[model samples]
Target: MVTGPAPTAARRSVEEVRERVAAVPDPELPVIGLGDLGVVRSVATGADGVIEVEITPTYLGCPGMAAITSAVRDVLTACGHPDGRVRQVLSPPWTTDRITPEGRRTLLAHGIAPPVSPAPDGPVAVEVGGVPCPHCGSRATRPHSPFGPSRCQSMLWCTACREPFPHLTAL
Candidate 1:
Protein backbone atom coordinates (compact mmCIF):
# COMPACT_ATOMS: atom_id res chain seq x y z
CA MET A 1 0.00 0.00 0.00
CA VAL A 2 1.18 3.51 -0.70
CA THR A 3 1.74 5.14 2.64
CA GLY A 4 1.43 8.84 3.33
CA PRO A 5 4.16 10.88 4.90
CA ALA A 6 4.66 10.25 8.59
CA PRO A 7 3.18 12.79 10.92
CA THR A 8 5.65 15.53 11.86
CA ALA A 9 5.77 17.52 15.09
CA ALA A 10 2.38 19.00 14.15
CA ARG A 11 -0.72 16.88 13.75
CA ARG A 12 -1.70 15.70 10.32
CA SER A 13 -4.57 17.48 8.62
CA VAL A 14 -8.13 16.19 8.82
CA GLU A 15 -8.41 15.93 5.07
CA GLU A 16 -5.29 13.76 4.93
CA VAL A 17 -6.71 11.31 7.46
CA ARG A 18 -10.13 11.41 5.85
CA GLU A 19 -8.72 10.59 2.44
CA ARG A 20 -7.16 7.43 3.75
CA VAL A 21 -10.08 6.45 5.96
CA ALA A 22 -12.52 7.08 3.13
CA ALA A 23 -10.76 4.38 1.11
CA VAL A 24 -11.52 1.78 3.74
CA PRO A 25 -14.28 -0.53 2.60
CA ASP A 26 -17.24 -1.48 4.73
CA PRO A 27 -16.86 -4.94 6.27
CA GLU A 28 -20.34 -6.10 5.25
CA LEU A 29 -20.53 -4.27 1.94
CA PRO A 30 -17.06 -4.53 0.44
CA VAL A 31 -18.27 -3.08 -2.83
CA ILE A 32 -18.97 0.23 -1.12
CA GLY A 33 -16.41 2.32 0.76
CA LEU A 34 -17.22 3.80 4.14
CA GLY A 35 -17.18 7.27 2.60
CA ASP A 36 -19.59 6.25 -0.12
CA LEU A 37 -21.83 4.61 2.46
CA GLY A 38 -21.77 7.88 4.43
CA VAL A 39 -20.64 6.08 7.57
CA VAL A 40 -17.34 7.85 8.08
CA ARG A 41 -18.74 10.96 9.66
CA SER A 42 -15.55 12.80 10.49
CA VAL A 43 -11.83 12.41 10.78
CA ALA A 44 -9.69 14.59 13.00
CA THR A 45 -6.10 14.57 14.14
CA GLY A 46 -5.09 15.69 17.59
CA ALA A 47 -1.98 17.66 18.51
CA ASP A 48 -0.34 14.41 19.56
CA GLY A 49 -0.77 13.05 16.02
CA VAL A 50 -3.45 10.54 16.93
CA ILE A 51 -6.26 10.30 14.42
CA GLU A 52 -9.88 9.85 15.44
CA VAL A 53 -12.51 8.64 13.02
CA GLU A 54 -16.17 8.95 13.86
CA ILE A 55 -18.67 6.59 12.27
CA THR A 56 -22.37 5.82 12.58
CA PRO A 57 -23.67 2.30 12.27
CA THR A 58 -26.44 1.54 9.84
CA TYR A 59 -28.42 -0.07 12.65
CA LEU A 60 -28.33 0.06 16.41
CA GLY A 61 -27.05 -3.49 16.78
CA CYS A 62 -25.19 -3.77 13.54
CA PRO A 63 -22.71 -6.62 13.77
CA GLY A 64 -20.42 -5.13 11.18
CA MET A 65 -19.61 -2.06 13.30
CA ALA A 66 -16.78 -3.81 15.07
CA ALA A 67 -15.25 -5.00 11.88
CA ILE A 68 -15.64 -1.59 10.29
CA THR A 69 -13.88 0.01 13.22
CA SER A 70 -11.00 -2.40 13.03
CA ALA A 71 -10.73 -1.89 9.29
CA VAL A 72 -10.56 1.88 9.73
CA ARG A 73 -7.81 1.60 12.30
CA ASP A 74 -5.87 -0.80 10.14
CA VAL A 75 -6.13 1.45 7.12
CA LEU A 76 -5.02 4.51 9.06
CA THR A 77 -2.11 2.67 10.63
CA ALA A 78 -1.04 1.32 7.27
CA CYS A 79 -1.11 4.84 5.93
CA GLY A 80 1.39 6.00 8.61
CA HIS A 81 -1.23 7.16 11.12
CA PRO A 82 -0.83 4.72 13.99
CA ASP A 83 -2.92 4.51 17.14
CA GLY A 84 -5.98 5.68 15.31
CA ARG A 85 -9.27 5.76 17.19
CA VAL A 86 -12.67 4.78 15.80
CA ARG A 87 -15.65 6.29 17.56
CA GLN A 88 -19.25 5.19 17.08
CA VAL A 89 -21.64 8.07 17.47
CA LEU A 90 -25.34 7.36 17.99
CA SER A 91 -26.70 10.87 18.37
CA PRO A 92 -27.80 11.25 14.75
CA PRO A 93 -28.75 7.75 13.76
CA TRP A 94 -27.68 6.63 10.32
CA THR A 95 -30.25 6.44 7.53
CA THR A 96 -30.38 4.83 4.14
CA ASP A 97 -30.61 8.32 2.70
CA ARG A 98 -26.95 8.78 3.62
CA ILE A 99 -25.81 6.34 0.98
CA THR A 100 -24.46 8.22 -2.01
CA PRO A 101 -25.82 7.87 -5.52
CA GLU A 102 -22.60 6.18 -6.60
CA GLY A 103 -22.85 3.81 -3.69
CA ARG A 104 -26.39 2.91 -4.71
CA ARG A 105 -25.24 2.15 -8.22
CA THR A 106 -22.39 0.07 -6.90
CA LEU A 107 -24.79 -1.89 -4.66
CA LEU A 108 -27.11 -2.53 -7.58
CA ALA A 109 -24.20 -3.63 -9.73
CA HIS A 110 -23.18 -6.08 -7.00
CA GLY A 111 -26.64 -7.65 -7.07
CA ILE A 112 -27.76 -6.03 -3.84
CA ALA A 113 -30.84 -3.87 -4.08
CA PRO A 114 -30.14 -0.41 -2.74
CA PRO A 115 -32.56 1.07 -0.23
CA VAL A 116 -35.10 3.48 -1.58
CA SER A 117 -34.72 7.08 -0.56
CA PRO A 118 -36.98 7.86 2.38
CA ALA A 119 -39.27 10.86 2.46
CA PRO A 120 -37.47 14.07 3.30
CA ASP A 121 -39.82 14.66 6.21
CA GLY A 122 -38.84 11.59 8.21
CA PRO A 123 -38.21 7.85 8.24
CA VAL A 124 -40.68 5.52 6.55
CA ALA A 125 -41.31 1.80 6.68
CA VAL A 126 -39.81 -0.20 3.87
CA GLU A 127 -43.00 -1.93 2.90
CA VAL A 128 -43.61 -3.97 -0.19
CA GLY A 129 -43.73 -1.30 -2.80
CA GLY A 130 -42.26 -0.65 -6.22
CA VAL A 131 -38.72 -1.67 -5.40
CA PRO A 132 -37.13 -2.72 -8.64
CA CYS A 133 -35.15 -5.93 -8.89
CA PRO A 134 -31.41 -5.40 -9.07
CA HIS A 135 -30.69 -8.33 -11.34
CA CYS A 136 -33.37 -7.91 -13.97
CA GLY A 137 -34.28 -4.30 -13.27
CA SER A 138 -37.92 -5.34 -13.12
CA ARG A 139 -40.49 -3.76 -10.83
CA ALA A 140 -42.07 -7.16 -10.06
CA THR A 141 -40.27 -7.67 -6.82
CA ARG A 142 -41.71 -8.68 -3.46
CA PRO A 143 -40.37 -8.98 0.03
CA HIS A 144 -39.58 -12.59 0.82
CA SER A 145 -38.71 -11.90 4.42
CA PRO A 146 -38.45 -8.94 6.72
CA PHE A 147 -34.94 -9.98 7.66
CA GLY A 148 -31.92 -10.77 5.57
CA PRO A 149 -28.44 -12.12 6.17
CA SER A 150 -27.66 -8.83 7.87
CA ARG A 151 -29.78 -6.60 10.08
CA CYS A 152 -29.70 -3.73 7.61
CA GLN A 153 -30.99 -5.80 4.72
CA SER A 154 -34.21 -7.56 3.79
CA MET A 155 -34.79 -10.63 1.65
CA LEU A 156 -36.48 -9.79 -1.64
CA TRP A 157 -37.55 -12.03 -4.44
CA CYS A 158 -37.99 -10.88 -8.01
CA THR A 159 -41.10 -12.30 -9.61
CA ALA A 160 -39.95 -11.72 -13.14
CA CYS A 161 -36.44 -13.08 -12.67
CA ARG A 162 -37.35 -15.69 -10.06
CA GLU A 163 -34.27 -14.79 -8.04
CA PRO A 164 -33.78 -13.83 -4.46
CA PHE A 165 -31.64 -10.85 -3.51
CA PRO A 166 -30.84 -8.84 -0.45
CA HIS A 167 -32.35 -5.38 -0.28
CA LEU A 168 -30.81 -2.78 1.98
CA THR A 169 -33.43 -1.75 4.50
CA ALA A 170 -34.33 1.91 4.47
CA LEU A 171 -34.03 3.43 7.91
Candidate 2:
Protein backbone atom coordinates (compact mmCIF):
# COMPACT_ATOMS: atom_id res chain seq x y z
CA MET A 1 0.00 0.00 0.00
CA VAL A 2 1.24 3.48 -0.86
CA THR A 3 0.78 6.36 1.55
CA GLY A 4 1.44 10.05 1.29
CA PRO A 5 4.01 11.73 3.49
CA ALA A 6 2.71 12.62 6.96
CA PRO A 7 2.19 16.28 7.73
CA THR A 8 4.99 17.77 9.78
CA ALA A 9 5.74 21.00 11.61
CA ALA A 10 8.08 22.02 8.79
CA ARG A 11 5.14 21.95 6.41
CA ARG A 12 3.42 24.82 8.24
CA SER A 13 2.18 27.44 5.76
CA VAL A 14 2.36 31.21 5.85
CA GLU A 15 -1.36 31.32 6.56
CA GLU A 16 -0.91 29.09 9.56
CA VAL A 17 1.84 31.33 10.87
CA ARG A 18 -0.34 34.37 10.33
CA GLU A 19 -3.29 32.79 12.08
CA ARG A 20 -1.12 31.92 15.04
CA VAL A 21 0.40 35.37 15.19
CA ALA A 22 -2.98 36.99 14.75
CA ALA A 23 -4.10 35.40 17.99
CA VAL A 24 -1.25 37.05 19.89
CA PRO A 25 -2.57 39.74 22.23
CA ASP A 26 -1.21 43.24 22.47
CA PRO A 27 1.12 43.64 25.41
CA GLU A 28 -0.63 46.71 26.80
CA LEU A 29 -4.13 45.93 25.57
CA PRO A 30 -4.53 42.32 26.52
CA VAL A 31 -8.19 42.23 25.55
CA ILE A 32 -7.50 42.88 21.88
CA GLY A 33 -5.47 40.67 19.57
CA LEU A 34 -2.70 42.14 17.48
CA GLY A 35 -4.64 41.35 14.33
CA ASP A 36 -7.74 43.15 15.60
CA LEU A 37 -5.58 46.10 16.57
CA GLY A 38 -4.21 46.17 13.00
CA VAL A 39 -0.66 45.93 14.31
CA VAL A 40 0.26 42.84 12.25
CA ARG A 41 0.75 44.00 8.69
CA SER A 42 1.89 40.84 6.97
CA VAL A 43 3.36 37.39 7.52
CA ALA A 44 5.71 35.63 5.16
CA THR A 45 7.63 32.38 5.32
CA GLY A 46 10.93 31.93 3.55
CA ALA A 47 12.02 28.77 1.73
CA ASP A 48 14.30 28.04 4.66
CA GLY A 49 11.21 27.90 6.87
CA VAL A 50 11.99 31.16 8.65
CA ILE A 51 8.85 33.20 9.20
CA GLU A 52 8.96 37.00 9.12
CA VAL A 53 6.18 39.19 10.44
CA GLU A 54 5.68 42.86 9.66
CA ILE A 55 4.14 45.09 12.32
CA THR A 56 3.21 48.74 12.65
CA PRO A 57 3.07 50.42 16.02
CA THR A 58 0.25 52.67 17.16
CA TYR A 59 2.81 55.37 17.62
CA LEU A 60 6.53 55.94 17.59
CA GLY A 61 8.33 55.23 20.86
CA CYS A 62 5.42 53.18 22.10
CA PRO A 63 6.86 51.40 25.15
CA GLY A 64 4.83 48.27 24.45
CA MET A 65 6.58 47.63 21.13
CA ALA A 66 9.35 45.60 22.70
CA ALA A 67 6.90 43.51 24.68
CA ILE A 68 4.71 43.01 21.62
CA THR A 69 7.70 41.89 19.55
CA SER A 70 8.79 39.44 22.21
CA ALA A 71 5.26 38.06 22.44
CA VAL A 72 5.15 37.53 18.69
CA ARG A 73 8.42 35.63 18.76
CA ASP A 74 7.19 33.49 21.63
CA VAL A 75 3.93 32.71 19.83
CA LEU A 76 5.68 31.87 16.58
CA THR A 77 8.24 29.67 18.28
CA ALA A 78 5.50 27.83 20.12
CA CYS A 79 3.67 27.35 16.83
CA GLY A 80 6.73 25.47 15.42
CA HIS A 81 8.29 28.51 13.76
CA PRO A 82 11.30 28.89 15.99
CA ASP A 83 13.08 31.06 13.47
CA GLY A 84 10.33 33.64 13.28
CA ARG A 85 11.27 37.31 13.36
CA VAL A 86 9.22 40.46 13.74
CA ARG A 87 10.06 43.55 11.71
CA GLN A 88 8.67 46.94 12.62
CA VAL A 89 7.46 49.13 9.77
CA LEU A 90 7.34 52.84 10.44
CA SER A 91 7.43 54.27 6.97
CA PRO A 92 3.70 54.82 6.55
CA PRO A 93 3.14 55.21 10.26
CA TRP A 94 0.07 53.93 12.10
CA THR A 95 -3.30 55.65 12.38
CA THR A 96 -6.30 55.06 14.57
CA ASP A 97 -8.20 54.42 11.35
CA ARG A 98 -6.31 51.16 10.99
CA ILE A 99 -8.04 49.75 14.06
CA THR A 100 -10.63 47.12 13.21
CA PRO A 101 -14.30 47.53 14.10
CA GLU A 102 -14.06 44.59 16.45
CA GLY A 103 -11.04 46.16 18.06
CA ARG A 104 -13.00 49.35 18.62
CA ARG A 105 -15.79 47.41 20.23
CA THR A 106 -13.36 45.55 22.39
CA LEU A 107 -11.76 48.77 23.54
CA LEU A 108 -15.13 50.27 24.35
CA ALA A 109 -16.23 47.18 26.22
CA HIS A 110 -13.02 47.33 28.20
CA GLY A 111 -14.02 50.82 29.38
CA ILE A 112 -11.64 52.59 27.06
CA ALA A 113 -13.17 54.92 24.53
CA PRO A 114 -11.92 54.33 21.00
CA PRO A 115 -10.62 57.16 18.91
CA VAL A 116 -13.13 59.00 16.85
CA SER A 117 -12.86 58.37 13.15
CA PRO A 118 -11.64 61.17 10.96
CA ALA A 119 -14.34 63.06 9.17
CA PRO A 120 -15.02 61.82 5.66
CA ASP A 121 -14.48 65.22 4.13
CA GLY A 122 -11.11 65.71 5.75
CA PRO A 123 -9.16 65.14 8.92
CA VAL A 124 -11.08 65.53 12.15
CA ALA A 125 -10.68 68.97 13.62
CA VAL A 126 -9.29 68.75 17.12
CA GLU A 127 -11.56 70.67 19.42
CA VAL A 128 -11.67 71.30 23.13
CA GLY A 129 -14.92 69.54 23.58
CA GLY A 130 -16.43 66.67 25.42
CA VAL A 131 -15.49 63.12 24.56
CA PRO A 132 -18.08 60.44 25.08
CA CYS A 133 -17.73 58.76 28.44
CA PRO A 134 -17.34 54.99 28.23
CA HIS A 135 -18.93 54.47 31.62
CA CYS A 136 -22.12 56.48 31.25
CA GLY A 137 -22.19 56.94 27.47
CA SER A 138 -22.37 60.67 28.10
CA ARG A 139 -20.89 63.32 25.87
CA ALA A 140 -20.30 65.40 28.96
CA THR A 141 -16.84 64.06 29.48
CA ARG A 142 -13.82 66.34 29.69
CA PRO A 143 -10.16 65.63 29.35
CA HIS A 144 -8.83 65.20 32.86
CA SER A 145 -5.32 64.88 31.55
CA PRO A 146 -3.77 65.05 28.13
CA PHE A 147 -1.98 61.85 29.02
CA GLY A 148 -3.02 58.59 30.56
CA PRO A 149 -1.24 55.57 31.99
CA SER A 150 -0.15 54.77 28.44
CA ARG A 151 1.14 57.10 25.76
CA CYS A 152 -1.73 56.39 23.39
CA GLN A 153 -4.42 56.97 25.97
CA SER A 154 -5.83 60.19 27.38
CA MET A 155 -7.42 60.46 30.79
CA LEU A 156 -11.00 61.68 30.68
CA TRP A 157 -13.53 62.43 33.38
CA CYS A 158 -17.20 61.83 32.85
CA THR A 159 -19.44 64.45 34.35
CA ALA A 160 -22.38 62.07 34.25
CA CYS A 161 -20.75 59.15 35.97
CA ARG A 162 -18.13 61.14 37.88
CA GLU A 163 -15.60 58.53 36.91
CA PRO A 164 -12.32 58.69 35.08
CA PHE A 165 -11.66 56.56 32.02
CA PRO A 166 -9.03 56.19 29.33
CA HIS A 167 -9.67 57.40 25.82
CA LEU A 168 -7.64 56.10 22.92
CA THR A 169 -5.94 59.03 21.27
CA ALA A 170 -6.42 59.61 17.58
CA LEU A 171 -3.29 59.60 15.49
Candidate with top TM-score is 2
Residue by residue across 112-149, what tens digits does model 1's lDDT show?
A: 99977866788776666568999988988888999887
Model 2 regions more than 4 Å off: 1-11, 47-49, 120-129
lDDT agreement with native, every candidate = 0.84, 0.86
The superposed Cα distance between candidate 1 and the true structure at residue 18, in angstroms, equals 1.3
Instruction: List the candidate 1 regions with Cα displacement exceeding 4 Å.
Output: 1-13, 47-49, 119-129
Candidate 2, residues 79-112, lDDT tens digits: the string is 6777788999997998888889999999999999
Estimated TM-score per prediction?
0.81, 0.84
State the lDDT at 9 in candidate 1.
Answer: 41
RMSD of each: 5.2, 4.9
With a 3 Å backbone cut-off (N, CA, C), the pairs that clash in candidate 2 are: none
